[model samples]
Target: MMGVAAAVFALTVGAQAPAEGSDQKRRLIEQKIRLVDTLINSPAARGAAEGQEAGSRALIRQGTQAIDDARKALADSRYDDAARLADDALRAVSSASRRMSPGEGALPESAQRKNLQDLGDQVAMYRNSIEELSRDAQKGSAAKTLLGHVDGLAAESRQLADAGRVGEAGKRMAEAYKLAVEELSRLRAGQEVLLSLKFDTPADEYAYEKKRFASNEIMVDMMVAEGRAIGDKRHLVDGFVEEGRRLGVQADEHAAAGQHAEAVRLMEQASAQLIRALQSMGVPVF
Candidate 1:
């Protein structure tokens, strides 16, 4: 009776253990899936996803080149050096992925700057990881082959990371940031130029006035987009005020050109245009 009872207990315990193990695996898989989803949806991930399909051939070419390099390094018995290079190559691939990710596009300037800095840090981390592995690679032929495979993977990763959809997305984000900075600089420059100009003649004043008006229009559009992205109401209001000032300047320019009646018409028109644009944006432009 004792022996029979012990067997029954042991079997029951074994069955319950398997069930618990299965549950644990399911939970782990779910967590991993969530992590993957977050990475895929990231701006950098989006950029990376964009060109990957079309850039597969280029990535293959890069991988091939890297393999050739590794083969030469191995022949020369620079095993550790080859390993480091291979690791660096792998990091390039990772960088490419980051560059390609689409979600990076919507990032604000401060956020985007941090992203680039973080990528540089990640590269450093990969270098350290690779160096640690290189120690084992020096021990034997099997380790060399393993290292070689890792090298190939790194090469391929570097190749595909950028050439794929993400490269173009990275370019767009870079351009957007550049344009924003340029626009902001232009506004500052225009302000300085306006203040410094010696408008001794009407023609000189007219040119300066026209230039200022044009600059103001550009600033308005840029700031509108920038403000929306950064959620900055102050930038939006400042843009509106600049627009108003532009109209007033244009009216003065017309009067300087000996067209008082036209000046009056323009002044009224400018006010209406500014009001309409501001109102549409839900701004109180009074």
Candidate 2:
């Protein structure tokens, strides 16, 4: 009985040794996994942080410049200029924040959400301000000056878009609202020059261009005729006259299609050819 008990005790010790060894191996494996995970995340976090910092720095610079410009304008008693500059600076700051924020992979959940929300609000405010400015330019008797602001707004919007600040770019135009108000004011005040132009449509403009070319041909032909009559400078005169006639006939077609600008241009070209022909023959200008 004593011998059997000793054997059983020995067997139990052996079993315990293997179990403990297995546990240690498992712990080592788990620790290695954790270390690798940490190693992978460290670089990604750093990259995200660096990107964010760079973006922030850029935004700060833009904001500073804008503010400086505004202050200068204000000092000069240029209220409108100051306001526009301030608005532009604020917009730059908003755009930079979005670009600086770590992409989804890098930022902690909370940071990303906050940044995005702030960006949205900034865009909305910019749109509103721009719309007001646009109207003021159109109706406040300084429409031309307002046009410059409108252009600035457009440029800023484009810059934000190019800078990967997409949300700001999509913001509605504040200038449009301002333009409407200005238009209303103009209607009531009966302003001079009403900011209007009879710009021809694309089709009309294209037709006119064709007519101008034709007019050149006509003038070329007239030059050739004179050159033939004058003798010796026939080759040069012929070339001009032929080109002029062709252009003039083309101009006529354009004119018939109601392309007055084209017809006029072509007529002028024809005249040029006639002059060239006369000059080549040493003929006197009539």
Candidate 3:
């Protein structure tokens, strides 16, 4: 009986060792995920909002989904899976952050005069594009608004350069360039282009849809806040805000049902409505 008990005890200890190791790994992964989350919510992330890149957007969506999956796995007592998923989340967000960063080659500090000149030329090109877009009666307001922002950024960049802050100046120019590119793309490809999602699989599509819905929900709140701050005294913007909320609800339903494409469409519609409302209230969407 004593020998049998010893063998059983050894088996239990061996199993407990692996379990403990897994738990330790899970904890470490959780810590890493938290660190990555900080990067995801950092200023660079905010800067990334100035424009969209398919790869960067995909990474963010993948990271968000991975984090959620990790938590669910943890709840289900799949500690090893949880750790792996959490690590994946960390990598995704880190990659996304890196992708969103402005190219080092474009930094003004690298070649101050050349970069500045290039930026100026690009700004000029965008100005022409904006002018052409503004000719369309339907897009006039949006074109004007975007042009205003671009002009403001261009002026700021020049001022920063004058102050010997070439790097900062280059950043401003970079932002302007991104904004211009997005606008041009929209004008050329229609509004839906702004909402386009390129994913490797249905799972990727679902993840992106889920993440975009959350983002649009936040945008709705921002639109409302800005509208109120500006005193939508006439409540002219209320209709658009309400429509955005309604669409967001529909988007949530679609996402829950795994109708990712529909969810993305609704989320995009909601975002557009909110952006229009904000623009009407003189708030810059960017």
Candidate 4:
């Protein structure tokens, strides 16, 4: 009688365990769904999505799909599937957040000044490229107008910085960048742009590329900060950033050893990794 009772108890426990586990998983899925829904409907998230060309719906497609699928799975009593779908939804929301930053506060004074300089350089480069193009191009008038606006923005940025308004200066530079980039895109439409800028030496080319890479790195950093790509992306972003930093350090060592060629190669490699990192973060930098 004792042996039979023990056997019955064990059988009953085994039968109950699966149901309990499934219940736990179902609760988890419901919790995750609630959290993800709250985040997806938050003001910041909506604003961030609207900032993109495709609007809010475009940014949340993956996440919404996951939510829908998770609901179906839950209804069907597929607790594991529901949990997995909820995770996917959470990641999608995180990725969207990291894309545009929604409208975060500006960086500190020093960072703003530095960002202004970098952004100014980017805008100037685009302006110069537009100006250097032949006047007979189809977009001649558009390019000229853009250059005028860019020059004005550059001057305004300088004035603002001189008055210790670095934050405003950064905004001006960002605007100038948008204008210049749009003009460049228009000018480059339906034609390949000629590489007109010539470097005096390999070192000069290397320096240019290094500056470009630094600018890209800064922009990505700022975006990450504003968007808070924390939950699932922290480790991945750190890994790529670390790889880029390591490569940069090695490049510096080579440069100090008088290997300009090798330094340039390493610098390019670092830039590539940084771009790769941005892509991994769903930044659409490519």
- Compose the digit string of candidate 2's lDDT tens values, residues 179-265: 323333444354332322234674554444343333222223333433433433443454454335445555666677987777767
Per-residue alpha-carbon lDDT of model 3 for 88-126, expressed as tens digits?
Answer: 775576556545333332222444444555666556666
Q: Name the runs in model 4 displaced over 4 angstroms.
A: 1-115, 134-136, 199-202, 221-243, 273-286
- Highest-lDDT candidate: 4
**lDDT, candidate 4, 1-119, per-residue tens:** 45434322332233234657776666656756765686577554565555443443565788889988989989998776776777677667645644543123223455456667777
Best of the candidates, TM-score: 4
Q: Write the per-residue lDDT of candidate 1 for residues 1-286, one digit (tens) a residue.
A: 4543332233223323445564443333233223223333445434434434435324433533554564466457554444444433333332333233323343343434443333323233333433343464433343344445444544443444456434333334333333322332332332321212355665545444443333333333433554431334433343344334445555765786897666655565555544444444443322
Off by over 4 Å in 2: 1-232
- Which model is ahead, 2 or 3, in terms of lDDT? 3
| Ten contiguous residues with the weakest lDDT in model 3 | 7-16
Candidate 4 weakest ten by summed lDDT = 7-16
- Alpha-carbon deviation at 161 in model 2, angstroms: 74
Per-residue lDDT for 250 in model 1? Answer: 55
